[model samples]
Target: MAQADVEVVEDMNVEGGPEAGEAVQVLRRVFGYEAFRGSQQEIIEHVIGGGDAVVLMPTGGGKSLCYQIPALVRGGVGVVVSPLIALMQDQVDALRALGVRAGFLNSTQDIEERRLVEAEFLAGELDLLYLAPERLRVEQTLSLLDRGKISLFAIDEAHCVAQWGHDFRPDYLALSMLHERWPEVPRIALTATATEATHTEITTRLRMAEARHFVASFDRPNIQYRIAAKNEPKRQLLELLREEHAGDAGIIYCLSRASVEKTAQFLVENGIAAVPYHAGLDPRTRAEHQARFLREDGLVVVATIAFGMGIDKPDVRFVAHLDLPKSVEGYYQETGRAGRDGQPSTAWLAYGLQDVVQQRKLIDGSEGDDAHRRRLSAHLDAMLALCETVECRRVRLLAYFGQESGACGNCDTCLAPPQTWDATVPAQKLLSTVVRLQRERGQKFGAGQIIDILLGKKTAKVIQFDHDALSVFGIGADLREAEWRGVVRQLLAQGLLAVEGDYGTLVLTEASGGVLRGDRQVPMRREPEKAARAARAKAKRAPVDLPEEALPVFEALRDWRGRTAKEQGVPAYVIFHDATLREIAVLRPASLDGLGGINGVGENKLAKYGQPILEVLAGRGTTDGGDAAGAGSGSDHAPPEPPDDIEEPPDDIDW
Candidate 1:
């Protein structure tokens, strides 16, 4: 893609930039926020005072402002090292819309574009300059940076520096050079998701061990966490979109390219606008699909893990996982892509027995030494624990990041608590069957055969092996096959059972001896069938809390935004977020000053789009696009109360 055209506001780029004490002034005038949120002010002031820092904030926690405001106050271009080459344009677009003179140098830019950006940087005409980490490897790029007046180095998505992180990038290992080369320049490394281990790894690898670390709470209470047993996942996903999130933008993640294609096709066949994205698609095709998903409304992108790394779109309503994620970090990062507007959204997953079996088989057959396999296994174990936990999902998730949080009353477990049963006898029976088959018959088999023998199915293979005559045979007949599968899955999750070989044969782990010897009791969660029913009964779509009269104004403003975004060739949120529009509708601002007082209406935006927004508010430029409110305002039922534990930001804060 060519560079996006941005009309730089010359007045904001004056020499001797705003003083450090003017941080709040810059925040209000440039970004249009009245106050700092959480630790944003602390982080911004620290950076502006020439102190290195590390920030671990949630997705919608306003991480950008931590560096953007500091860069604006500290003067000179803030050199940002980002891994998102595809998203740099959108980031710069958003900043330029705020009247911040931002530019980027990446592979997507032609030589002319790169030269122009480099010229702007050398002349001190840009406020922020974004570069992919890999670009710094080039001597010319380093020389270019050395020649420019530097402000600070901002590393976005710094978790990629962790060697064991889910989204590790080798290019990030070279980022430590920023510290060595520019010792006087302040630097800030930021990520939305990281464990204590990953955090330490980032600090160590990025040479920021002494930097003041700001670890915000990992909780995103606006997202309703739900995991259901997989039964016709495609159909379940279809029902979720149609019944709850119809006409809303979402992302559906699958485990394989073929699954991505199939799921996208399924949704499109069912009359939902959807597209497929995976590594298998051609680069241009992937780019087109991503652009459509970003620029258009209510478009679903079915992808593997290859997508959604630095996506800045703020209105994604749901993120559904058809297959299991390998780790809580991966799950958290993917799910964080939803509810970024601080609106009610969903992080839904469809997990089942096959998911467990498949993951184990992949690990066993993976090309790694024992230590690597062990690491992968540990990550999977944590994820499985989260999926199978009877406690609150959010609590378990936050616990993984070394944070403590109470049971969020919105997750699946809190809403409809699953029952736990003592499955010691059933576990013993299953392990005994595996033992008998291994010691007596000198044979091993997959779960299907093992389950058949346990239930005494007397299938042809069972009879051929004379398994029906075994002492353990028919011992588990009291439980149905589905229930037995659940037992095996739970056992695997609990590490009492292990899967081996290409066919996923059941085996005993070191911990299984205690269960087999009656030294330990196995407890398992009963599937939350009632929870599923209740969730289905209640509409999963988020409700708009605006007064009935304000709904139309909100829709009209959205219509105007969509058109303006199309004209500017940028994502709609680059113009203004839904949260900003909702407040505008509620307040019904009547003039430029009134509209300018709203959050997200920065000085540049106030001058550029203020009149148009006021026109829409006054019913002059209103269009017939009430579909904008369909996702959140269709239901007649009152909107659900916001969770008590979540801290609400001020009405004037930009999401």
Candidate 2:
């Protein structure tokens, strides 16, 4: 059949193409799923009918399939505009494993590689082609696309196009040209995180305002969200990992490069395998660290926000934040990285008064204009509200995206409801201290000195300033230092108190007048006591939901998968996700036909690995003898050791 005629038939007739139900057929024959999830089937049909769409789904919600199935059902090569150059190879490898002819063009490719992919694309042999968004600037690339038989455009991580978003990429600003140039070709923009404002921004910036919008619920019920007061956070993180997530694949996000290094080193010293990632590292070192995290099991990656945007690893068991995120969108995006395989996981964060002070200081010192600073403060304010709320975290989180949901019963607030006390008196006392210092002494002080004076403790700094002699010195003695700090934090969150200067000195906002005049009530969330916290920690360490006899079979299948992944030099999940393996072990499929019916076992995979999977299930393959509880879901084998003297490369190297 000629290419034009084939394209016309596929585009016009969904029921009577070469085969009926082509999208479903591709889903089963290639990606291996029985039914489409959520709005996936509707989105696929719309795109296959040559219509544009804006898709808002949570991470691991199968956004890829929304575009992939359409690309397979429609004619020509589907051009994917992706920002993750480093991960393109893994994506293509995964597609090729499913027997799809996939390729990518990026700066990482050599002249020969680029020519080969270009030739394949021009010949209409490539089913899908991935391109970095920046490549569209090159005339050669635009001309190249014009010569090829083009399918729909798939824009992944579409939130980056929003100028005010947490993960904005300047290269994405030019993406609207895709619609302008290819007026007839359909386009689909997909993102895992976006607020209502960001959603509108994406639509406006991408010129997709007329496209149908599909917004899915942003709840990941399998992930238990927990945020606690940051008491010695490094030690707290260590305890959490030791008790609940030992030997599990996880990501620990820090706010700075220095913190990333310290956290990784801390984990390594505590006998946990870990690697550090940040933009400051050389490109090669970053790539190698990313490769290790993807290929090995039970490896922890300590990183800044630079990591985890396009990471496809499905078995990450936890995501911990030692520092507070700047915004709710960022927090959701980072935490969404965990439990991609739909297994139970933890999204733990250690927050404290210092986090708020530090974030405020950053905004003050930031280079943006007044309007930009206001935007930044708005983001921080929403995040603080989430941390301080006594209600369900999941409900608050989903509501930020304009999706209303009831209490999830799984978050920290719902599982152990916190006591909300009338802190109006404490709030007045703290604000009074600030006023006395500013009016009488003509001075400003940080939270430490203020707390010392409130508690009437004659510490060195207090005595140095003669703060012990103040009129309100001992009035707050009824509250402990921690309780006073909580009052201060709550006041800051309420905007009655503000942090100023590099030292984060306390100052009063316009809202402080009502509190001082007894016209406003301040309610504060009481932090969970030590015993309650310990109980929750213990509960999180419970075993995975699997039958006793199936544990060994699961371990054996993981062993086989690890070995196969190593043989192919791809990530273990690329062969088959842990969720898929868990089901296989539970069902113990005895025949090839039965194995093919599993969720992730596509035709190519069933024909290739089905027999070996059965062998592992039947006890023919070698199994690791260690207790499955100790090893968790990752492989028992350790990855290779990284070099000790890794250094930053020259400036010319492309990262």
Candidate 3:
């Protein structure tokens, strides 16, 4: 045979699979994408050619396509190991909608359901099969895999293999057996959030050290970063909701279950459709609320960290942290859930001195080795630095993930820059107050108490302790109360002050001596003026500039989408994302071909909902979608007691 014919024969005979270029064909035909993004094509080819790989892409960066496409081109079933059981069905359902034979087996399945899937697996009928890591430990599961061709292994959320990861799963440690048992099979591990340390841990633990690593940029520029000094957090959050994100879907993350309930109740009372999610709720309640949040539009979920791991909703307009996230990676992953469709979103946080104290105390009281405590402390320090940063927030955030970028003008600092002051003198006074209260008066106090003494406020505690007699008392009267609080917080962040005992009493650290002697200088960011903040909020809340005629069309399309999703028992975004709806509304696509041309309106979706959507746009359809639009809230308020695992400290101390 000629050289070309020989090559074709080799391609056709290789495991009786599609040709080498079949991966791209699968991408366009099955997934409905025109092309590969970033290193997707390269990753797919490497895995299909039977090479080990590791991928670290940001959330919403198309990580799934890396492995999903390879599964289609290669022979046999592609086994995906996922950590979240709640997310497995959604993943499988989405794949099925794309015309791929996909299935999942977990505790949620009945014995008959599992037996059917097992039979299919043995018959070589599945293109993609998702399994929770714990399933791999079953002898039947291992035996079933042994009976098949076993194309390749895809480990989703591979960062869980790292013990220090935000969502670590012990069962993920068992996944190393994939490499050990199926030595010749190609393996691909992927995560949306991983630091350099976590990256190393994933490789080491998964035994994929030799895998080719594909790292993508961690920056999500469409999501604006904003952090404010929490003052009356509930009211401030209400103001944020009213002024900026009115009638939008979003999430408010609290630190504890009680806080979740209270915040949810507060929002409901204020006329917002809100619900709470945490481990404390009954499992059925959590599942029901999750279903509602996913299937409905304009819903706000006030929840703890338990709420967002496998959330695939793309229209979350904002993620507000009422409590500082435990680590920068956790914050990145949580905020990444917003604007998954690349629309403008916000990552808003309300941070205060009490957050620092509470987080520190949690770390201190945690049951761990010294090394573990130090690691936790290091993570907290990074989180605090991100909040205290005066420069671009994106710059600091991306740098933590080993990528460098210029100032992103979308962040709060870049937009409404704060004034920095030479706070050396103020730092000295704050440190001196801590030292005097400790050494001279033998009275330890928190930031609030220390600030009262500094500003010459003779509260009952100061009068009782005779703190009014101290030399440092009233010396800080020149600065306002908020400024003094800022100094104390900066001092704590700088390691010049430490909280000791259960009361979170402030005590001077060894570093405090340098500042007291004028040998150290502290630069503090002055809080943005109230008027400047109001201006920025107003600017952000400016009405969308859609064409006059498009407004009604957009609303009608949303209504249609909502109804269709409710009837189908799926999320509205599953039918068509808000961005896709907006495109259709603006373009006013008149035919199936026109609708198919719009992004996110794939072949399958167009074939299914095309006519109804057209009718809705044409204003002849009396059919209903669901109510697809709603409003926002913010703040870092105190939550109820956290479950034992969440590490909330006692609230008796006056932080």
Candidate 4:
């Protein structure tokens, strides 16, 4: 914060045996970033000084710089082992643009390309070389070592060393070779997610046994968590798209290939810019979809869990799931993708009973032993508990990962708040219907048929089963079928209603004991499914086909950003992100202070561009928020946040 405090923070550094002033300068020059982010400066000094380290920084915490700066300042090339090809390319390209010597070896590279990279490596002309762990153990890789010097072996995504990690890679196991072959080379392992176990596992696996651990704060204050019951998940997701996510950068995750395609198509038909991606798709098609989502603004990509392992897109506004994730860690990592740029964003999920059933079925179908199955079930149970919680989701999520957070009042539970109603009767009716249908037809009926029987419907299946003869028949006639479905889904989430996937039968697990015995009064929303969906639909405002009154304002801001970026020689984002731009456009901040209050602007930036921006805001000079006149003292004073409006973008555009 202050100069003296910064010095104090850096003063606590440890060293293996090296100087680091040149490294700091390299950092400032190439990245235009003034200083290293927390523990980074010290971590760099430690690595360059010659000890291995493990860094646990949040996403967007600038972990890459901790290694990159030291690599350039030190005597030899930095060998960075990474898992994601996309992440590697993005990092390398960004480094190369900054005039740094960085290259990577991936499946995408031709043999000559690999040879050339290795040649540069031997010549000692490369500052850093990215390696996929899978290729790091081969003879060719070992041969490169004789010709090239390794200053440090940096392992990114170090959490992959843990079996519980969402992005676990088998290749990560080979990292022990780095320690075996080059015991002299310092290793730095970095990850955004690592509980106590994961952290311990990384160091143990890499044999960086004595690594100085630097664990930064795990606070992502900008992201909000919201979970809704799986009531018409499709429509709920659509509501999310139109509301906060309309024309915004975001990702929606589903559990299946069919759901992925269907969701993407549904979103596209509903007028959102969306596409589906999964392992089942052709690689080229998947790559194209990913590229399009990355390069373009306002694109929403719906995909299976396979997507976005190491995507570097910075402005994702929200992350929504149409189905339940396999584990809480999976959900956390995926949802963490939102608000990465330190702006407020949302993580919304609409889940239901079938998702839980499907997830359990998949886990059971796997070749794992009973112990392994129990492990999977434990993770799933935790996730379902999170979904069922009326308490703060963020607190529970962080708590699961061994971090503590107080009530944040930022999640849905802290906002509207859930009010649970006694559902004893509904629960008994649901169980009885399942039992009656299974007994009569010699098989369990799906949710629809069960709901029909409960409501006295004479559908072909229900009539054939003669389920109305059951004691619980017509007992739930007052509740709409969808409401009953919601009840059933919630029961499944609680592990009270279990499905036999192979036979498609409703087999109550032992966990269902309380619900059947009326010992558990299931808490449920009393609202009918159709009415609930309608309420959600109404809550989300339709996107302004073109909010035209704000059009000129947005164009002017973009122009200002470009001109400022050119003069300052920084990327447009270093000035302001698209979200900030959109807000500026929408609000049309009448004063420099008002502009600063819009999120990205701060006091220091105000002094530099305040007047020019204010002049533009006042509609003066060539463009308003633009100024031919130099900045003045008067422009230093700013106002409050601009009020909201149902305005439109201008017809004439500049883009």
Candidate 5:
């Protein structure tokens, strides 16, 4: 079915709400945007016209406006079912900043606060109401909804409804009841991450199979994707922080809580303002650290995967992973946190053979049946293939999600394509050795032992097994141990080798037979020279340039934003994102009206923060005094956007 255009429906009465044409007006006056991007205009029109939708837009792609605008144009309050309280709070705060009456019902709210929000909802004063799925499951909450007029139901993070999704929410399983009870209400489910299976599961579970599916491109071109072999990962991460992302707010994801603590400490010791966050930490400490990460500038949060699910920090300059992510979907979502202001950012990872082994063991040890294990294995295999692939990482990443994309020229492979060589001989030798070891000793050995035998090392185990007597013992002497290790890693990635048992013994898979019999040729990626790799990594750093004159004013605005956010006890971006500040710096708006003309500065924000912004722009250096004419409203100049990558959203609701 084709998407409907946002046309003026003549003679159509929306009962108590604004007509269809009023969406654009509300978009401009309230949220300060004059148009929509991609299918946002159509999606908003459909939902407002009482239709359902399943939107798979990327993060920072104006997914929120698809629901928010319709909610405003509709007759009643838009109830958004969110999985996390922090996410709800961020969305609500951003909506309120736009002068929209939005509130959230969650466990974090006290009785009085909840009551006030409920009263507002019943009075039909709220444009949007964000609710945690857990709260929505309550009888009283459902009863309250029955008592009020609802515009539409929006399910954010809709992928959570899939039991197999990385961020599955048990509470979301109860959300189907919303449709069962309110059969007349239109519903829209939205997520930034979902594969075909997850997508189907979402629509099936939510009973929105008939909902129009709007899937935008998953490519985040601004985020540079680089995967390097793990070599002293901590030192590499430190170098990444120092040389690439100095004084930038980012997240460094570790695989374990202990690693998170250690990495945070290491960063702090190295002069980075860093904090540790994980499920193991006390709630207060975690909350405090998360708050600081959000509230302060250039603070790094070293954490496990648990840290970044609902993070609304738009200017997270980078997302570095000290360990490999479990799947492409997980990696995509985790990295999607960065560069959300649309500025250039990086998604860097340190992957190695150990990651392969650890992930394999994790899958094997997981409590699941064979089918589940097989699915996990497939996911791991795909992840490994991506890490080891010489093709564009972005291309492969998107392909994994069922989207065919051309070479991005942004990922590590496209920037520095890896060299490949025919490794049929070496592969045959390695597989023959494994077969020899199994046949001669009726046992499989680890890669170390196999490489030892191949490199003609006379170790005790080799001697004990009398491996020196074998014909293949010295066959691989021409290749160095590291080269041989590469061969093994590649073979494992190719499914020609498998690591079994706690000892990580290498065993031949069925695919090994073709190579051993010379029926197939093996092509392997040659590890880039260290100097070349370093040079490529250096070249991949995104350039950030500001005019020399605008530098001081930018810093001044940042200082003012920091101070204001501190006083308000909110993230600096909550006051104004760095992109907005950059725009202000470049434009140097003269007055309140000039500031009001800015894309992100709505009437409420202009009135609340106009004078201070003007003072900063008038060379006041964050002080309270400046000539109002030099710093004040003069013209309705529309400030140009920050950069090509730093896209400005037309509206609010930081989804």
Candidate 6:
């Protein structure tokens, strides 16, 4: 068949059948699971029913079953090509324990062992044969799969196919060979993380452009989102570990191998069961360390970035980053490793100005593209904005990804919204510090030196340059060093500060110039600690805390949406969507004014869901109490605004 024809058939709508019914029966019998979720049945039908598809599901959302159950029904030795040896072995072993024939091929297998496995695969004795992607190009391997005509190709961690991805691999490049060699067979590329750009890249790169695309919804209600300033991070972490994550599986991320070791030791000293994992350790030691983390329950793994990518464990309750990740995608992909069981989880990070300089240095100092560097730095800046966002964490994150989210009560910012104050003067002072430091040292200083000089702290460098005597010295005496750090951080987040390593200095951006000139409205927000604490406590409540009147309606809406999605073989939100649901709840239009009563609902969506939405919100259970509030009074947790005289900007847009 032509590629376009294959595309048509791959996307052609097909409903459930007797075979699928039998598959469901067997699913309950062997796996002891009730039924399939999301598009698992359709995904399996596409793959096992002899077609192509790509599945995007969150971790612990049963991605494995999409391939596992289909492999059994396909009636051939299902050849699974994956990248990680540990993940491959875990899947293969689990299958074997279920009384099904399964095996794996990797460097771990000796020559004699390879011979035995190869012989079984050829003799049709194995139902599933898992091998590393790097090994798929070998002569003996491809020859056998070509001779036997292996079952569907399941590509786990399919996001790695995109060069723009965080975990891209070179060997994954050869995966297009599957399309060439197995043109008649189906292919399924699955990944947990792929934004719009990466999503498009996967289809183009994997040669799956002609295959079915299943994008599951991105909402993870169970995961509590958080971003905190780097205020006594060590002590803060200890308290969080003891309180919220007590006796739960978690991951604590640091930037370096030494930091991993030290932090792990510190946690151990404080009575948390933890161990370090990093590339610095010997191969044997790394293996043992990873094995222990997987085997033992609730054991925390403190490590650098190397410890990720291969982990498949579920029920990880928390993921904390002691330092900032390089990009928002890196942050999302890493933090996503937690709360995989669809249970309550936390995504927390402690960051500050130093994190900014380090990340910029790493990016500018790397061999990657200048454009990629710029984009990465911009993305990090956006994340820093999220850290300082007083609006809502979930809303900000969703906005960055080109989606809109209602206030998520589960995030720190939503529980106790940061109280805003006019900091136009402090901001002007800070911007002036940059101006003075740049001019004084012949434009040869960074934020750290400027901060020191501002706080009246004289050092050898300050004495050498006589910066202590500068007129700007002690001008910022009103604020402590920590508060000054907060100001600098907010400036960086706002694009008022830029650190280019080549300059080895802090250069004020146009935004800073405006702030200094008193021509912008500078809204300053303090660190949100109490909001985060309330979010932690409020999580004990159920998901989607709409008021009591809105429950049945939301539930009914979700059910109808779920059914529509399965029938179309698309994600739930894509059909009849979230915007449609929200308009229904908020406006309470008694009749189909065609969504005219709703603010966001336009003519197009109104034509599609105006009636359905009207039906749901009208028969309400409760209004969304909205996000977490002060538990006692449920008062607007927006922090009390600081004094008005703090600062005021000139009354016009400077830009």
The local distance difference test score of each candidate is 0.80, 0.81, 0.75, 0.68, 0.76, 0.66
lDDT of 5 by residue, 222-254 (tens): 888888877789998888878777778888988
Off by over 4 Å in 4: 1-24, 432-443, 518-655
Model 1: residues >4 Å from true position, as ranges? Answer: 1-20, 537-543, 620-655
For model 2, the stretches where C-alpha displacement exceeds 4 angstroms are 1-20, 530-543, 620-655
- Winner by TM-score between candidate 6 and candidate 2: 2
lDDT of 6: 0.66
Model 4 clash tally, residue pairs: 19
Going through the candidates in order, what is the number of backbone clashes in each?
0, 0, 10, 19, 5, 12
Residue-wise lDDT of candidate 2 within 1-655, one digit each (tens)?
0111111111121232234477878876887666565577789899999999999988777788888888888889999998887778878887887888999999999999999999999999999999989899899999999999888999998999988889888889999999899899999999999999999999999999889999988998889898989889999999988887778888899999999999999989999999999888888888888888877767889988888886766667789999999999999998988876566788999999999999999999998799999999999999999999999999999988888899987778887888899999988998999999999999999999999998989899998999988998989999999898888888888899999998999999999999999999998899767533753664566455566545666767777887888898876666776657767766777789888878778899898898889787666322333233333444433321111100111111222
Tens-place lDDT per residue, model 6, 1-655, is 0111111111213244445576665454444333555677778777877888888765445566777777778877777777677555555544553456788888887999988888888888888888878888787778878767477788877887888677777778889989898787788888877778888888988888888888766666667888777878888888788877777777888998888899999999999999887777777777666766654446788877766653544446788999988666677777877754344688888888888777777777877788888777777777677777888777776676556779877788878778887877878877787777677556658777788888888888888888887888877888888888887777777777777776446778877778777788788788655876686677545353244343345445666665654564332323332333443544345666634544323344456556766555544433343421222232222211110000001111010
Query: How displaced is residue 264 in candidate 3, in Å?
Result: 0.8
Backbone clashes counted, model 1: 0
Those runs of model 3 whose alpha carbons end farther than 4 Å from true positions after fitting are 1-20, 530-548, 586-597, 614-655
Clashing pairs in 1: none
Give the range where candidate 3 is weakest over 10 consecutive residues by summed lDDT: 641-650
Tens digits of per-residue lDDT for model 1, 502-552: 878888999999998999999999976789656555434445568765666
How far is 61's C-alpha from truth in model 4 (Å)?
Answer: 2.3
Clashes of 2: 0
